[model samples]
Target: MGKKAEILERLGGIAPALRRYSRALCAGAGHTLSDELVQSALQSVGARIRARELRPADLQEARLEAYAALTASAGKRLTDASRPTPRHPPIVHGLAELSLDDRAALLLVSLEGMGYDAAARVLGIRREALLAQLMRARAKLGVVGLPPADAESGARRAASHLRIVK
Candidate 1:
């Protein structure tokens, strides 16, 4: 295969992982966001590959760059994914509790599966600072109500409804 084809193949291999990461990144929001984020990230990465801005030796770097691009894109919009969420807990609460930088830091590292160094690079911050932001974000997550036990039940119901729709 040609170099461009080879790179596309490699990116395709990583797409499922990217989707899982994106889902977790936008967890507690809406289902549509997971698809949107993954699509955006892949498109950004594909563009970079097509432009030859990323080399084979730098695939991981390219992935991180793509993730950063995705997050930056997210930062620009008022994207309310059309998926209707439960009214009781308020969809925006957990996210709103976080400072934007902290939320971005948490999502990139924890949900997007970007390593600390990679996430730090994406956020243009030192690893230590990124960790601190993540810590703060996690702490803030606890203040919200839903509680751990109820989350599973609620998730199951949501999953059942989602599956029915599908």
Candidate 2:
């Protein structure tokens, strides 16, 4: 395959993970907004790749780039003062309580299964800083000592009130 085709293929492979991460990032905003975020991120990444501004050596690098894009886009939206607040479950409200950095750190590491180095790179922070942010996020969410599965399940239960529309 040509270079562009290869890049497109790799992006397609990471789309599911990107969507999941975007949803977590959007939490209370619901799936529609999250899907839009994912689309924006993908477009931004694709444009950079095409312009030769971002050259991912492999799938992992591509995933990081995609994540960085999504995080940036989400940050802008979350910080927009004019945006109306949407009703969310208590769990989502808890997530919204976190600073953008903390939430991104927690989700990138916990939900996306990104390593400290990769997550740090995506957040444009040092590994130590990432750990600190993750700790704060966990503490805020009261999931400090809980296992990952338990924390995730709790979030799922809290979000269960949201009905999924086909």
The candidate that achieves the highest lDDT relative to the unseen native structure: 2
Off by over 4 Å in 1: 2-4, 27-29, 79-84, 87-96, 145-166
Pairs clashing in candidate 2? none
Q: What tens-digit string does per-residue lDDT give for candidate 1 at 7-62?
A: 67677666666665554445445557667777887887788788887664545766
Query: Candidate 2 lDDT (Cα, whole model)?
Result: 0.74
State how far residue 111 of model 1 sits from its true place (Å): 3.3
Every model's TM-score: 0.66, 0.78
Query: Model 1 — which ten-residue stretch has the worst lDDT?
Result: 157-166
Give candidate 2's TM-score: 0.78
- Compared with the true structure, what per-residue lDDT tens digits does model 2 show for residues 30-80? 677778888888889888888888888766677788899999999887653
CA lDDT, candidate 1, residue 85 = 54
Separately for all candidates shown, the number of backbone clashes (residues 3 or more apart, or on different chains) is 0, 0
